[model samples]
Target: MIGAGAAGLATAIFTGRSSPHLKVLLLDGARRPGAKILISGGGRCNVTNSSVSERDFWGGRSTIVRHVLSGLPVAETVAFFGEVGVPLHEEPGGKLFPDSNRARDVLEALLREVERVHAHLLTAHRVVGISGARGGFTVDTLQGSIAARAVVLAAGGQSLPRTGSDGAGVQLAQRLGHTIVETTPALAPLRIGRADGSFHERLSGVAHDADLTVWADRQVLIRLRGSLLWTHFGVSGPLALNASRHWARAALEGRAPRMTVSFCPGLRFDDADARLVAAARERPRAAAPTVLAAWLPASVAAALASEIGLPDVALAQVPRDDRRRLSHALVEWPLAVEDTRGYNYAEATAGGVTLGEIDPSTMESRVCPGLFLVGEVLDVDGRIGGYNFQWAWASARAAARGLATTL
Candidate 1:
């Protein structure tokens, strides 16, 4: 194992336990293992999801993902973690976290399993290169070089560089004759270009449930519904993070993607228009901002009302055309996204080693025999909540099974 992250650690645990006669060595550049796990889910460590499927991921051979995941499904992951002493509890959206509500506990459980199998864990041993092929492989590290029959590359992606995934694995794979997909920051907060007078500047720190959609070249790319948070830069929160992938990819391709927030999610234009008309009729004395406040946050209502030029006017006093305009603005508030926060703040990277080079059933490299690639090191990223971690678990298990069989 060339990394000790979620995938690497799991691979070590499974490989060691399954093939006790074989020697297993897990190496990491970090001083401690599971650095990402320690900070995941705000320290709660979302280990897996209650329901996982190939559709949840982006940028990979979907067939390979499906094959690997089916081999070790989410149910099996839940049971495996439980058996390892990390009881799980499910939250909204099928997200599963440790019952203890501490990421340390989850890390400890994985470490315990690694110890149980007597796998050699060498922290601070950064792998510089790998030479040789198939049955005889030499892994070069800062400390020294070690020989191995097989090598597993789970060094992860460039999303959280501080967490020890600094694109080293991608570089290593590239050196070994693998095609790497262009990587970009995904699940990161977007940076909206400031208008002369941007409402987001004043609305910073405001959060509310909203529907977000990405549009590029006049075509809708994706739609998501979740909490949308306004920051001084642009937008953050679940909805914005989920939609960032589309926007980032489009931006990278030189196609500027426009993001529109629908404050009144699930409401048709006619329905939203009707609601405004009814509000005008029922609460004739109510101010437009006040009427909007009934459905939206006070800051959001004020911002929308100001943007629509009806900040203080009475609801009934507004003309029919202005009412229609207000309805449109309320439902489809346009935002100018300049760029993303980049990989430093991204939750996961959007691209990695292309999946075509790896065998779906075993996660072994077709280009380099005896070499396996798993986790975010491959072009497999999942949406927020616990899907990415589930990928880590499933892919690691698949690679372990393959390694055991080959041995």
Candidate 2:
């Protein structure tokens, strides 16, 4: 096994347990493995979601994702963790975290499982190259080189460079004659340009529930509803993260999709207008910002009032044009997305080795015999919850099964 990440660790454990007679080497470049796991989920380590589906992911084919995930279902994962002395508890959005609420516990349990299975895990053994095929293969690492029958590339993609994954695995796959799907930052924060007169700067540090949508070529790309946090650079949080993939892909295509946010989801323009009109009559003496604060943050309301040209006067004293403008702005405010924050801040990569190059049932490389690919190293990225971690687990299991049979 190559790379001692989440998928690599799981693969090593499963492979060692299945075929004990076969020698297994879990190699990683990091001085201490599982850095990503340690920092994941605000250090709690979201292992998996209680309910996961192909719909939660993007890239390759949904059928492939469905097949991989179904192999080792969420129930199996939860049960395995429980048996390994890391009982998990459910949180909102079906997120499963360790009962201890410590990522160290999760990593320690997995490492202990690897040791129990007698898998040799070597840290700082960065794999530099791989050559040969089928029964004979040589894995060249910075530390040394080893001969193996098969190699599994779970080195991950170019996200969180500090964690050790820096797209090295993707480059290795390309040299071995497999097509890459061209990677981009997924689940990243979008950087909004002030060209559109955006008030994002003024609304910084504010967070609220809102509906975000990406529009491209007069078509709705994606719509998401969740908390949005306004940062000085851009928007963060669940809603913005979910919509970022569409925006990034569209920008890559030069389409430059238009992004919009709705403070009141499902509120039409007419309805929003009427609501504001009624508010004018009811809270006539109230400040415009105070009235809008019913749906938005106080800072956001003030920023929107300033941006929409709503006068500083009382709600009822505002001009008709200003009132209607505020209503329209509240309904579907355009977000001037300039670019994504890129791999630096991205939670997962959008693309990598295309799924077509690997068998969905086994995660074995179709282009290169005796080669397997798994996890974020492939063209698969899920939404911000625990879906991505679930993918890592499922894909690793599939690859391990293939290795057990082949070895």
Candidate 2 residue pairs in backbone clash:
none
lDDT of 2 by residue, 1-407 (tens): 88898999998888888888888888898899988899889999999999999999999999999999999999999998999999999999899999999999999999999999999999999999999998999999997789999999999999898889999999989989989998889988989887866577777888898889899887888888889999888899988888888888887787858999988887878999899889989988998999988877788889888877678999899888888888889878998888889888988898899998899888999999999998999999999889988999999899888987887
Residue 64 shift from truth in candidate 2, angstroms:
0.6
lDDT of each: 0.89, 0.90
Tens-digit per-residue lDDT, 326-358, candidate 1: 888877888888888889999899888999999
Q: Which stretches of candidate 2 lie over 4 Å from their true place?
A: 196-198
The TM-scores of all predictions, comma-separated, are 0.97, 0.96
lDDT of 2 at 92: 94
Q: Could you give the C-alpha RMSD of every candidate to the true structure, in order shown?
A: 1.3, 1.5
